[model samples]
Target: MILTVDVGNTRIKAAVFEGNTVLENFVFEKNELEKKIEKILEKFPNCSDLVVASVGNIDKQSFLTFENELKIHFLTNEDVYPFVNKYATPKTLGIDRMVLASGATLQFPKQNRLVIDVGTCITYDFIDENDNYLGGAISPGLRLRYEALHNYTAKLPLLAFEAPELYIGNSTTQAIHSGVVNGFVYEIDGFIDEYRANFSNFIIILTGGDAVFLAKRLKNTIFANSNFLLESLNQTFQYKIDND
Candidate 1:
């Protein structure tokens, strides 16, 4: 078994994969990294490989502590990817995005793919049918929008994400919710629409913390799986091993 980890800006998401199938999934804060992994290992003693793709502030050396128990593989910009990265600045591409792109290429071959990851930041990555990653866009996520309002304004309260009760908010709190949630939904739909205008045989894969919350709200059709990054990390690793 292989344990695939995706270290995002806010949290670490991991999954144990028996080949292409995920046996279990886990989410934990950076501070709980060691404890969480130990518990996972205790449960799945067969897990002998730890594959990680980090886009967080945590030091890479932190994962090395497990070297004795399992082989550690860190996916980096220098590693092999399935797609032809056409980004102008290939070296600057985030490892998380690269993994997502590789997964899209490997899982959905001979098609155009648009991957939208909505977590700490909303990222859009597009790969063409020919397996060329052309890149996408990024915007502030729901939490960021809410925090921005509270931080910039003195009266607006910092609120947790809640579905807006109505499109036209009746109160201050409701208004904030509607503006943030509805506006965010529209922004994503709008991007999907723009992509639809020019692409055919295209597929949109949406993943991240807010994927489920926004999935129902999105007007466009999408394959929404919050655990996609972890799954993709596993696929990417296998691909690297096979092709290396």
Candidate 2:
């Protein structure tokens, strides 16, 4: 089994993969880093390779602190990728985005792919049929939208994510619900529409913490899997081993 971990802005998503199949998945808060690694190793002692893609402020020493004999592999720009990154500042490009792009390119070859990650932030990354990594957009997440409303104005209370019963909100809470939830749904569909206009037979992959919550609400058709990035990391790890 291959241990794949994706360190995002708010959480660490890890999974155990047997070849291309994910045996199990795990999520941990920053404080649970040790337990996270321990649980994986305890369950899969034979796990020999650890593949990580981190976009958070986690210290590299943190991973080394574990007493596992597994070989660790961190996905970085320094590693060779299957896609041609065309971002203006390739060096500054987030590894998460590239990983998503690579996942799309390798998983859905010879097709235009648009990946929408709805986590701490909403990220849209597009890769053409030729496997070229082009840039996309980033926006506030559901929590940020709610937090912004509360922070910016005193009257608006901090609200959790919930689907409004009706599109037209009647009360103050409902109004916030409609404005935040519906607004985000519309924004996501809009982005999909914009991309669809340019590319034909495009593959849309939606994956992140909020993916399942928003997937059913999306108007456009999408391949929804919250564990996609972890799967992508596993794929990248396999590619590295095969090439090595």
Error of 2 at 144 (Å): 0.6
lDDT of 1 by residue, 1-244 (tens): 9999899999999999999999999999999998899999999999989999999999877789889999999999998899998999999999999999999999899999999999989999999999999999989999999999999997899999999999999999999999999999999999999999999999999999989988998989999999888889999999999989
TM-score of 1: 0.98
lDDT of 2: 0.89
Cα-based TM-score, every candidate: 0.98, 0.97
Candidates' RMSD to native = 0.8, 1.2
Clashes of 1: 0
Which ten-residue region of model 2 has the weakest summed lDDT?
A: 60-69
What local distance difference test score does each model get?
A: 0.94, 0.89
Candidate number with greatest lDDT: 1
- Model 2 clash pairs are none
Poorly placed runs, candidate 1 (over 4 Å): none
**Candidate 2: residue 57 Cα off by (Å):** 1.0
